[model samples]
Target: PVHDDDDDDDDALITDAITGKRYRALRHEEAESLSDHLLSLWMRAGPGRGAELPVDSYKESVLEAVRASQVVVMVVITGCGKTTRIPRFLLEGQVRRVRRAECNILVTQPRRISAVSVAHRVAQEMGPALRHCVGYQVRLESRPPERSGGALLFLTVGVLLRKLQSNPGLQGISHVIVDEVHERDVNTDLLLALLLSSIKNNPDLRVLLMSATGDTQRLSQYFGGCPVVHVPGFMHPVQARFLEEVLTEMGRPTPPRRDREEEKEVAPDLDLVADVIDHIHSNREPGKDAFRADRRGRAGRCQPGHSYHLFPRKQLDRMAVFPVPEILRTPLESVIIQAKIHCPHSKAVDFLAQVLDSPDSQVVRVAVKSLMDIGVLDAAENLTPLGERVACMSCDPRLGKALVLSALFSCVLPVLSVAACLTRDPFYNSMQNRALVSKAKAALSGSSCSDHLVFSRVVQSWKELQGRESKQEFLDQYTLSGASLRFIHGLMQQFGENLCEAGLLDASAECLRLSSGLNQHSQQEQLVKAVLIAGLYPHLIQVKRGTVTKGGRYRPENLSYRTESGPVLLHRSSANRGNPDLSSRWLTFFSAVKSNGQVFIRDSSVVHPLALLLLTDCDLSERGNARPNHSVLLPGHSLIRWEFSPHVWELLWDLRTSLQAMIHRSLRRCDRRSTSGGCKDSELVALLVELLNNTDPEPGSDQEEFSTENIRSDRL
Candidate 1:
């Protein structure tokens, strides 16, 4: 519970004359009455520069539209003060006048950084009392101060979705503004659908959807033809150009993409983009035509909501209007599970299909089918016991599954750290310090191929540094953000608490013994990799015998062990990038994307093929071929061939089946009581570790071979 310093005084009580009820006396009432200072407080707590913004002219209309309807669509430009001022306007201007019901404004931002910074800016604009009035809630931090009377909450969309788990109707919040709806994440899309469904029962609830550029007509129609309001602001006109035109202007020929799949979705060519920008800077007068250079002579500056010229103009054309919706770009396992919880009686595909600007139908079908295969959902697309547990975890379904299995397998701490690192940014190295950062990362990795282990080492180093030096020194040495480290630490504690809350951890000696077995560094590393394999089996890849030239540099070709997406390169940030000897032959990756016209795996770990097969759902391929041609079928419809006798193959399958049953039983037994049951087979654990130890090490590629720079230059 959060304690308000202002309301903690014991000597500030007052008794009503007739009712005999005790209440805390107002702080201002000690010297001045409430009515005497109302106007002064209002002026201080309102918009700081209300006269300068275009939004001020339409403030009264915005309030009136909300009062008359249940929904409103706001089309505001980048810097029009819509995000920070609208909530304050509603709380002070309209809700105070009505006095029928206390109003609580909840604003949702698409990004966490925006949510926290906006909350701080709003609090600073207001005076002292308004400081307490404005609070923010994100994944790892929350300051919910006295939400009953009048409060302005700035939260990420994910937090609001979690709140809906308990308060589906959003009982206390009078109005909710879903900001940045154009950059549609899965959570934002889900929130819109939930609000649309709930508003029918909650006629008094008000919702405002704000975006810089959106499908206003379609969204307004979705909200029952809600009134649309556009607030204009000042912005410079931007020119667009084609890749060929820019390259020709730079006196260079167009470069070819590495493969055919890359043509579908290619990141902007940054080299060509930089050359074009330089040409523009040399040809035009800076003060009149473009942003003036700073003392450091960096000519271009990326503003908060404006696009930068560091990407191919063609790609910028698409991003100028909107970002690629996350549903189409990212894996949808967690989303499918959330949909199941929201519409338990309906099919997951059917429910997601109804969402506005619904994602690809084939994508939804594939996600649902994958979940069913993982045993999270049944054949009917209903949540199983494991699915319910996974739904409550604040992570991707795959990572959440890894956490659960880690607890059952007695390696929760390391896996918890890994999950936290994945959720939060642990490293913030800039291009100038890339060499030093790479060296430090290598030292932390301790010759492990797994980036997850490297992250754990970095976190441990940070903890050690906390006692010896200042935070600034640590940040400088590690090229990390201090805020990001604190956020990760908070998430670590929260994940531990969640384990206890889910009954997946306990005080029993047996459970403690299993977890304690991972005290040794070697033991911990092996178990962590095993849990990872269990979670991310089909994403494994292998080194193919080929070479490709990317950006005038040659690197070995990589292929997925299952899907065969070829010519993949290790991301520049990976610890294993420059090491000639990789830890293992096969690898498991978190994400694969085409950036800069090259395929790259973001975070990856090398794993033994035999170790991976242990976690796979083993079944014989359906073919009427000879015995030598028979192969084992794996998840994602992948097949693996090995030269083993039929008897030995049957024995391995039996062991895998046994391991699968033990994992299922242990997870099901984890309930509100305590985690007590798990496999205690020492020989099996030792054998799996031994197989991983005996695998041939992977040959590493050059770190500077490929450049995977971010194409989206701005975070608007």
Candidate 2:
């Protein structure tokens, strides 16, 4: 609940004489009265803006639609004031009718950049005095409204979903405006489902969905055919030219038609684009020439401009009108966990079925199986203690679990850095200087055989630099983007705060105590790799050694690897791609992408066999007719196998059991309340740390010279 400092006996109230109901609506009336006065002053002081937008003309209609219906779908075009003005209209419309304390309005955007930029624009339009009423919130950053109610907030869809997890009723919020509904991303789709459920129990809540290019009829029907208002855009006429016209204008003859076999030999898209640019530059005036090619219709009419069509009209017509809903295309693990958190009694599949476009049943089942396999969900399909902690975070379930383990292992800093890096690419891969960037990354990796570690080292090195100029030099040297590094830094701080909120870290020390033993064995790079193995398990890859020449020379690129999917090579951008030898035969990766008919695994790191045995999900069985005592098999992967002596296997099994038990107990404690004292040291953690330290053999040591025959493969 928001704290109301003005709640006093002297505060004003409104009385409904007919119904005898005492309404606390006078505060909103006074606030609006003052707001109007300030807005008038602001207008007189400066040039008026936003009054000429197409949406401004329909403000009264929009307000009337909201007043008459439970839902309103505004089909406004781009460059209209719907995104900025509608929320204000709704808030002002509730001036004397609803209590000021209950007039909270939330507007959601599809992306963080859009949310923040729109919020800033709205604030500027509201003027300096009234700007406090408008603000925005996104992941890791926010400038929320200063007052409790009678204020508008712009936020991303994901942030709103997190709010729903804690406040299912959406207590004080009176209106929710979901912008860009046409995009139909996973978060927006889930939010719509949850909002529908919320509206059933809360009659005071109103929803306004605004989209420029969405299917208005379908959206109106989805909201039970409440009301639809269309606002025309303020479009300027654009001069459009097709490709044939462009070639005619350039006085260039069309090339002869090619057979199917020769089509692949056609000039590349970039080369054609370059040629077009050169032609335009040669023909256009010195300073007034501007040529724009846009895929979206709205972009061409933002102002009076010329639009060049690069492709044929038939090709444009054949393209899909709208994108597929993300819920159907992407994995549903996060969606399932969020649904389970919000609706505990309902099954994940049943809850997801209510979404606008629910995913396939098989996809849902696969996600559930994955959650259960990772110990996030149990047999009954309920969130476990670990799952509850993972739910509090805004990252993937696997990455979230890795964060929790990092806290337990007292290595929060390094793990947080790696997790933040995984969210997006931080390094700048310049097309012209690709070789230079790759060489710099390899140098930073320094035999670590870890692309993830390279990111952490970059951040650490940047922090160590004393001055701004030095930091800039360091970034330039490594071809890193300053903005991206700052984003990662902000994410690290935000994730640390999340850890504190989840009770994984002590809030009092602000993560300082979480690193109590920085100089200890837990701080070793190998332990960080262990945590990565725990999170990115099942993404394991088995390294296939390349043949060595008589002179002991081998090409690192010849080293092929196998995943659950067939053979894949190391991505060229990986730090480990250039290393001649790796510390272990098994490696864990962040993800794999297929390009040009070849699959490449990226952001990889070598993991000790012991880390795989203890951290990953695998089954151990006795070898029936082999000299090896026990054989390890990953549950779903049949191509990979590991063998060890019986004595070694028994020790590993016992250690794994103990580690699991300790982690469960620790997570339960975190769930109960914030652990201000931080994670207590345990003998099991110390033992595991020591074991991990010993697993990584020193360079040139005898332990690093194991023969290739020890690794058995069915394919071989």
Candidate 3:
């Protein structure tokens, strides 16, 4: 039931009208007699009976092209049936012989939902025995209960890259169909480059670059003019309208505009969308006056008496047809890790330069620097033991770091929930079910403005209600995605297993369960927040106050924050968006991006100034080499004058160092017996627990912000 807007296929599940029984399409059976009834059903239900797709005509050409060349460029639009049908064509085309080579066709998709959906469609067509033959492998989940051996395997682009780490030559895969190459995402580009290199050694390995809007000539040239196959798609006609025309037809007067500075402080008027929809329904006609508008300028009529045709002579582009390559748009921590493991000898920047359409040099540099800050990569750009483990996780490098630290602190359950939520599709719809989802989330969140904690509660409630009610009913009541919930659960279990392997938790404790001795830390709010800091440090924003105006009427005073770009308000969907009293002076945000001409923080959590210092990378001045007024200087010369003196700062530093050592020792113990008893209930944990529990702020300190000035300067 999880639908991706990117997929345009109109195929629905087949059902019998008389019996109301749903059935899969008849599949080819190797050892069966084709009776008259079975033959009639096959003829009626198979692909040939429906309006023949363009790919059906090109099956011979496609197979011949694969036999002739090592690479092929397939430029087919959406709904051409290329994604689901072409793979089966290749698989079934194999000649039955005494010695059949392992000919597994690997089709890689850009999104997980696409891979799972396409695999299900292919499985249904392949019939029951072939149910195991057509399967998908995505992060945290795999169908058919096996790692490999699916005749036609569908997986995400990132998963394929991870596979390359183990089998750089892609040993068993015969043909790799890189779908949506037009996206030019970081994973797809990296994967294509690696495959091209592998094809030189293994010429038998076939590559197919498929896209709806790709530059065929460019791709063909990249493969040394590989054969290009064109498959025409069924296109749908759409109606278009400009905003100004819609407003005129609806008889809504335009509001006066303001200066650029005033515009930055105003929120978008979303009510206009509903008004346009209502007008379209109330006034739409068949032939005449359907979309006609008055031809008028602000001062005078544009054409005196004639009605202006609203449709443009040329089609107007609504949004960018292609995606911005992820290197430019997203954090590159995970990509950096992959680069190190796959291209070991080359530095991250050097290896990335060899990729097709490499990201900007500064962007790569910033990514490497961020990884170093998080202790994933050392000063020499080597993977630490922590980095080795983090690379195995299927999430952002920072979130992986958070999970590791949470395990060390014996608070893995909630942190696992937070980590899983970050790497999956959102639990609720902010557009249609915003108010209801928000009210439920707020009730669970209590006084915490941390979106991570709020989501943890939401997921925990869903878990508690799992058996009492059906999953679909629970999802309907909460307006959540069932697939996303399953994805989160899969990741939580995956994290627990990985933590056990890394010796961060007791071997006996499975799936988010902590040792009994360490269970008390799971209940502490400050400890969980501190673990989040270890992962999401340096992405901090200083909260500021501003005012927002809408239509010159609803001008409300607003509290906003500052990113490198400019001032940004929180998304209305955020738990902390309009609430200023929930520890809102400063916060750490997940991402800051511009949408609808205004920048906004997607998700954020508040951190106390002291907690920030304890969690971040800091060093105390040596006794002999002290700064004036006992100041503790962070990176970039952001100095913090100690509330007490040098000695108090030194004591706090020593205590933190001891706690880190204690955690490391606990993680290094290999035997379950050694990990089960002493370390979990040690006096060190008790002391650290007491320290985190203290909430009283230092009375006379004048520090107003905890800034990552050093981090920013290093990136520059």
The numbered model that scores best in lDDT is 2
TM-score of 2: 0.84
Off by over 4 Å in 2: 1-51, 96-101, 240-302, 308-312, 508-522, 547-557, 624-628, 632-636, 671-681, 696-716
Whole-structure CA lDDT of model 1: 0.65
lDDT of 2 by residue, 1-716 (tens): 22334655321132211111222334556656655654454446452346566777787889888878878888888777778778877766664353544667889999999899988987887677767777888897778876545577889998888777656656557888999899999988888888888788778888999888867788788778878888887766656676667777878775555554444334445655667778767875543335444433543445665566765444456557887888888879988998998898888889888888878877898999889887889989999887888776778888888887777766777777788888877788745667988988888889789998888788777767898999999988888988998888888788877777777765524443333552133357887888888877777887766645569988545666788778788888888885768877778987787766678887899887667667665565545445655566655676555555666656667778877766767787844243323443456666677676654432332222222233223211
lDDT of each: 0.65, 0.72, 0.64
* Candidate 1 minimal-lDDT segment of 10 residues: 704-713
Better of 2 and 3 by lDDT: 2
Pairs that collide in candidate 1 are 541-561
Q: C-alpha displacement of 403 in model 3, angstroms?
A: 0.7
> For candidate 1, lDDT tens digit of each residue in 94-125?
43463322456789998888999988887887
Clashing pairs in 3: 635-710
RMSD of each: 10.5, 6.8, 11.2
Q: lDDT score, residue 91, model 2?
A: 67
| Candidate 3 local lDDT, 461-513, one digit each (tens) | 67777463575686776567877888788888877776665556664245444
lDDT of 2 at 597: 68
Kindly report the root-mean-square deviation of model 3 from the true structure over all alpha carbons. 11.2
Model 1 stretches astray by more than 4 angstroms: 1-52, 98-101, 232-324, 423-443, 466-484, 497-501, 506-522, 543-584, 595-598, 620-658, 670-673, 678-716
